[model samples]
Target: MNHALAQAVRLAPVVEKVHGAHHPELTRVRELTQALADTTDDARIDGYYAELRAVTDNYTVPEDACEGFTSHYRALQESEQFWQNR
Candidate 1:
């Protein structure tokens, strides 16, 4: 968990760069990432990650977004073992 966490963290630095309402969300991400890195409970980590991803990816898929979520979700699952296991 610790090994790959840094890369996952580096993906969302924009939230922290700006000081505004978004700060709280990034702060929570930091807190949750820490908890996730420290946690060993499968259910806890899985539940937290699932909730986090759902909230972070709140954008709706436009009809003409060029692709369906199934493909995206499949790719995500294939590359991320944690997601695949789910």
Candidate 2:
């Protein structure tokens, strides 16, 4: 529900479109993000964070990442901080 999480929620579709349906990671990320957005319980958000971290591997960004990729990675990191600090 924080700004960074909200931003990542908004950015998911663009990432999915760029990665296409063939990219399983994006699909999983989109699903987990949507789940996070749908819930109000903090416990649920924490659970989602665990799954998201597994998917993102702590939001690690590749050196060769394009702008979109890097933005998406940074967004995840920011969102994670928002969630954890809550």
Candidate 3:
């Protein structure tokens, strides 16, 4: 796995703790990241990447977001960059 995806995987539990496991954004992040990681097909990768991009909203950090959330956001952004560059 790539560094960004690895970082996200590491941070996921912490982010869930801070944001709550059921948080929509976190759930989407987990779902999309996992899907991206699990897929090898080019079309599926692109599709998942697009969904992840839309969900992350350029990884804009919310004003009231906690450190965990911000960190996850950065990781997700890096993951996005990794996919885009690939």
Pick by lDDT: which candidate is best?
2
Which structure is stronger by lDDT: 1 or 3? 3
Candidate 3 residue runs with Cα over 4 Å from true position:
21-23
Task: Compute the lDDT of residue 20 as modeled in candidate 3.
Answer: 61
Over the stretch 1-86, how does candidate 3's per-residue lDDT look in tens digits?
Answer: 78988787778767766776445676777777777778778889778777767776767776767887888778878876787788
lDDT of 2 by residue, 1-86 (tens): 77877878888888878764555587888888889888988888888889888887877765655677678768877887877776
TM-score result, candidate 1 = 0.49
**Evaluation by lDDT, superior candidate among 2 and 3:** 2
Compared with the true structure, what per-residue lDDT tens digits does model 1 show for residues 1-84?
Answer: 443454444433433344225335555554555566667787887776675566446323324322333233232333245544
Clashing residue pairs in candidate 2 are: none
Per-prediction TM-score = 0.49, 0.83, 0.78
Error of 3 at 13 (Å): 3.3
Ranking by TM-score: 2, 3, 1
lDDT of 1: 0.47
User: Which 10 consecutive residues of model 2 have the lowest summed lDDT?
Assistant: 60-69
| Ranking of candidates on lDDT, top first | 2, 3, 1
